[model samples]
Target chain A: MKAGHRHPADDDQDATTQLAGIATLARQLATAPPSVPDIASRARAWRRRQARKLAPAVVAAAAAAAVAVSAGVIPGSGGDSPAAVTAAPAPAPPMQTVRFLSSMASVAAAQSAPRPDVFWYERVADETGPATESWESTTQTGLLRAADPQQTSAIAPTAAVTYFAYEPLTFAQMRALPLDPAVLAARMRATLRASGRATGEHRTGSDQEMFESVRYMLGWGQATPELRAALYRMLATLPGVRVLGQGTDPHGRRGSVIVVALPLGGVRAMLVDPADGRLLAAGASPDDASPDDASPDDAASQAPAPAATPGGPGPWTPPADWTYRGPIHYNVIFEASGYVNAVGRRPE
Target chain B: MRTAEGFEPWYAAEFPRLVASLRIATGDAGLAEEAAAEACARAYAKWGRVRRMESPSGWVYVVALNEVRSALRRRRLERNHAGRLRAGHAPPPADPDDALWRAVRALPERMRLAVALRYVADLPEAEIATAMGVARGTVAATLHSARRQLARELAVLTIKETP
Candidate 1:
């Protein structure tokens, strides 16, 4: 080793001896090395699994890069370096984006959803906050249920209504939606168009509406495996869908993330387990605005009210008015999800 | 044809040494295995290109180290260090009382990776530089720093033992 400190070259001898000692100790640490055949098999399995998950996006990206080079949008080096060849290209076209999502949908559809005799329970272990235990009744009700009565009181306009009367799609309602991607996308567009916020005050456009709608549906936690796959396919068909490549969920399950660009420079990412149809986690962050432009502290102050003018509707607004307005920068780790015999019981 | 036939022999010769180096780097056998397995899998995926590289082992080492570091960072974020160390998967080394190994473990991740790769894997300075994604000069300096720290630690132990 080079003598990094200002010292005589003779001191290298003593350092070498000490390094030898460290080497001896490190050798003892490996008493039983993993077998080559074992590792080779495991490695092959991992590669196949990752290829199964990411092949669609990988192909689409390569194809897009090729097109970009041919069209003179990006200069091609034609070098032998794999890095040069596989460097992520610019965002793919809408059709390619839809195809990538369809691939994910196909993977999801192959997995089976859990069927519980009692309730749909989820255990969430927040990285930085208190752990939460939530269970939703399998049977859908006309009125939404609140975990905390005090929270309901806070949202209600008056004391006369003790519980919040908000409404979300029932499990039956979600299951009734068309499984076809194009049909689902059209239905979502119409839902956004007819909503009061779409044309009335907020003027939230179809893109932001679709983003919120997907998050809303998935967060319900009662949708069937097929419905969840349809949701992924629908989001894939939306504009500005970008694959964020392979990522690990908060629980350390490896998966790929796809993000949707939202209005007012926001982006929502969904971490889907490609092995199964499980939605591992979901998160959102505001647009990549500089701190000077749109700091988290200045969000509400900077956001103009969504009031309408006489001439036309106001500019498009963020999805802040939704019932589940996720934190500006938060990751919800889905630790456990399955049907259980009782609310407090975990699946066997 | 010979190169393709020789691949299994090459893998067998390299796997243990690589795992040992990573085990020292990560101080977790399970993590070492996981990272090494993933790297090997990736290498297998692109063997057409990887085998032609000047140092295929260096490529595998770089990928495996990255996986381990990311896993460590994520674990640190999710739980306390004590909680992680208590995990049943990473057993205490055989020489649990060895101060030299303790000092080695205490070294920063990069320095540990450099030391382990050089000493255990017996990688040349150029290969170590490639594996660590650093200049050969940087690898030399890191190893130097690690040795100086270990020397100081051993000297203290000697003085204490003499009394």
Candidate 2:
């Protein structure tokens, strides 16, 4: 008899009894499920990501239409038959990066902001030794337990307020950042320009600087969820940003990676957890050489090859050897972060 | 033609069962929850189309399974790299004392998946086939083989305990 088909009545009954015991054991393993609000937030993030992924195709079609109209070859635009008019090639859209950031924004927006009196505590680890823990309060008071034995612990007076790239911001300034992406981007640009003039630095308000500023803010700055979301949205709009697909941090945590092409050379890669919008790791590689030319000594060059774009014609593979080769200069992973009531207290 | 209003209850009812089934299938609590939540999120994102399907739960099961598979693939690659760098930092093995769980986990991946979808998710053979991307007969055969193997394992355990 067929496996699922009924055989003798006794044999069917015996199988049913065995299956029941297995089902009971399986059901015993069930734990409490995640809350609905959490899943709903993820759904919103997924929707935003889907929208961003479609943006490139939409832009390409619009560009094609504009070219057709200008050429006077569009059939409906009172022009000749559309024959051999070629549309200018559209720049590859950073679909995965945009989607990942958009998802991060959604996840960030769903989180509760830190309380007024609470300190933002974080544990960070580098490629070297043990993890170090730090706690920074809004009042610019904090404590740091460094991994180095010589200076193991210290009272940090100005931990909370730091530069968002070249533009310095106090905790208050970070909290008061505009929630709208365009408005925030403009404000960041203005601040960057002003700071550049004050410091006599010629290169300010560049996309690379802006990208670094956003990365710093998202990584260490104590911005509100609204501001964090806004920063992510702003980052999505920046040029020269590309998704290098998924990768694992030093601590073996999985995350999606986004790389920003530096103005001078090479790329800055950041790994972020899409589930919670947390910055897992950030590093930079100084070589623009393709993977084929990558030296075997390059240890941190474990980035996955370009992934196929979802629902697109073909994979949006980065220029050959877009994967960074050579050791990452500033590789660091955030082990944990949370809010605590006091400077010395760690999150439970 | 179900509206977004209809998704709330459906999600609430199905999410736990999906997680439980996935937990059994993958033998990793964290992965199961993450995959199930992601699948439900995807379903909610495209509810207009998913709600109209013949089996929304089946679709969710398929998506969750795919997520688990992708994550496992990534983990394998990461393990290879981690092995070269560090000596021993692998994830903890699943529980060894639970004979039933051990038997289930010992089954082939496809058989384990079939059993989980059938027994834990309480899905019919047809839906299990759809979710697993196998024909119905294959699912039936896999489940039958799994049940027979599980029965023998449990019987030996029982005999050992009888002393």
DockQ (Cα-based) for each candidate: 0.18, 0.18
Task: Kindly report the docking quality category of candidate 1.
Answer: incorrect
Alpha-carbon runs more than 4 Å astray in model 2: A1-15, A57-348, B1-3, B74-98
How displaced is residue A303 in candidate 2, in Å?
16
Error of 2 at A335 (Å): 19
lDDT digits (tens) for residues B94-158 of candidate 2: 44466777777766667778888987788999999888777999998887777776666666676
**Stretches of model 1 off by over 4 angstroms after superposition:** A1-11, A58-348, B1-4, B45-49, B73-95
In candidate 1, residue A325 scores what lDDT? Answer: 31
- What lDDT score goes with residue B31 in model 2? 71
Give every collision pair in model 1. A265-A287
TM-score of each: 0.45, 0.45
Candidate 1, residues A1-348, lDDT tens digits: the string is 333443634444565766677656655555444455655576676655444334333443344444434444334555544344334342232565567678877877776766655456656554445545544455432121223323321110111101000112445555677988778777765554443232122222244445545654564346667877888877765555666566776556776676655433456666767677566676666443332222111221122222133212222322322222332333566667667665456666
Best by DockQ: 2
- B4: Cα error in model 1, Å: 5.6
